[model samples]
Target: MTARHVLLLGPLLMLLGAAYLLPFLGVMRWSVTLPEPGFGQYHAALSDPLVLGVIWRTVRICAVVTVIAVAAAYALTLIWVRGGRTARTLVELCIMIPFWISVLTRAFGWLALLSNKGIINGWLQSLGFLSEPLTLVRNEFGVVVGMVHFLIPFAAFPLATAMRSVDERVLLAARGMGASRTRIFWQIFLPMTKNGVLGAALLVFVFALGFFVTPAILGGGRSVMVAELIYLRIFQSPDWGLGAAISVILMVTVGLLLGVMMRQNRGAAR
Candidate 1:
């Protein structure tokens, strides 16, 4: 609040403004000023069937990824909270190993494993499980698998925190009262971790919305999401105005989701 405090914070604020704010402003400027100005680009992006379809697919795929990732995370969190040291170490390794790997590398790894002639199909064919390989890569299924693999760690951390915060005495008391494991889990444990699960879902959903590399590499241009579409519009097709318009729209959508997440956090705190 003092002048000295303001002076100390000024440099950091200026650095953020220069690094992040300015480029964002430039994108916002291009969205409206290019192609003779106005909001025509926004109208065009929204009205284009291809654009709409890409946006719809992005939302749908992200939603599915979030659901699966959160469920898997919940199970992992349970193991993390209740298991022995070896089990916990294994779970930690599983989550953190992929977390450290590059996104592009992970995508290509999935591509190799899921492609038509990939390991899974090869194994199946060798075992006489099928006459032909199943289509996995270059489609929605591959995209979802790649994304869910990427997002599980993101979902796990929050759920683990929530699970750790749960009171052990409450669970013990329920068990002493002859409440079944299933009944206690459904009635008590799940409700306590509801906020964490919701928070993880929203977080994963937002990240998945803007995913570019995984979808692009795995989808193989066959399944285009909004981010990939934006790249294609800007670099491949040379449509800066439309690309910027879509970028701005994507930014706004992410902002809205973050806002909802913050609101939920506040409600959970109370």
Candidate 2:
């Protein structure tokens, strides 16, 4: 608005342009430059069955993880909203403890627990619950489990914020009017927390789409997702163009979600 403001903003704008915008521009350039020019890489990405399968698998896994994460977060939010101090403390600890741990550590921990001779199988065998160890790790089930573990916190934290922001007087008034607990929760509480729950679901889904580490280690290369396939293409093979094409696609998908999120926030503010 003024010379002083322009002077103050110039340095930050320049820094952002140099540090962030230029690198993104480089990636965009590489998508077309590597292995000659044109849209051949993108055509391969969309036409190849392998690439298409990976994208479909990613969508399916993310959908399952989002559903489970949202449902679990909903239950946790309910406890945090309605339960006593001790219960709230326990829920807080559950959400907070994993937030501090590294993703790699968490993935390896799941690996140790889910392997054939892992702790869970040992316990089950000792208790005679199963005749043989179940195939748990290095598959879709293990990948989904690890992903859900990572995403639950993302889901819970936002819903908790939303539940807290909801006016308690609304619920109290509903109670005074003789509304049943189930009815109040379904009708009032659900509607009130809709924004947070949907926001968390979208957040988790987007994060899960680009997930690499857990699926990489836990999926055991058998269940390769788009991110891992991109990794292999870029690093293991000489096809940097294909990798760049997929990266651009992924970036576009994330950008679209971000745009929708911004629109939603603007509407909420309005």
lDDT of 1 by residue, 70-119 (tens): 99999997998888999999998998898679999999999999999999
Instruction: Identify the leading candidate in terms of TM-score.
Output: 1
Clash count, one per candidate: 0, 0
Top candidate (lDDT): 1
* Clashing residue pairs, backbone N/CA/C < 3 A, model 2: none
Q: Give the Cα-based TM-score of candidate 1 against the true structure.
A: 0.96
Model 1 alpha-carbon drift over 4 Å, by segment: 1-9
Tell how far residue 121 is off in model 1, in angstroms: 1.2
Deviating ranges (above 4 Å) for candidate 2: 1-19
Give a tens-digit lDDT track for model 2, residues 1-270: 999999999999999999978987887787888898998888999999999999999999999999998999889877977799999899988888998999999999999999999999999999999889999988999999999999998888778878888889999999999999999989998898888887888889889989999999999998998899989999999689989899899989988987886776566556
C-alpha TM-scores of all predictions: 0.96, 0.93
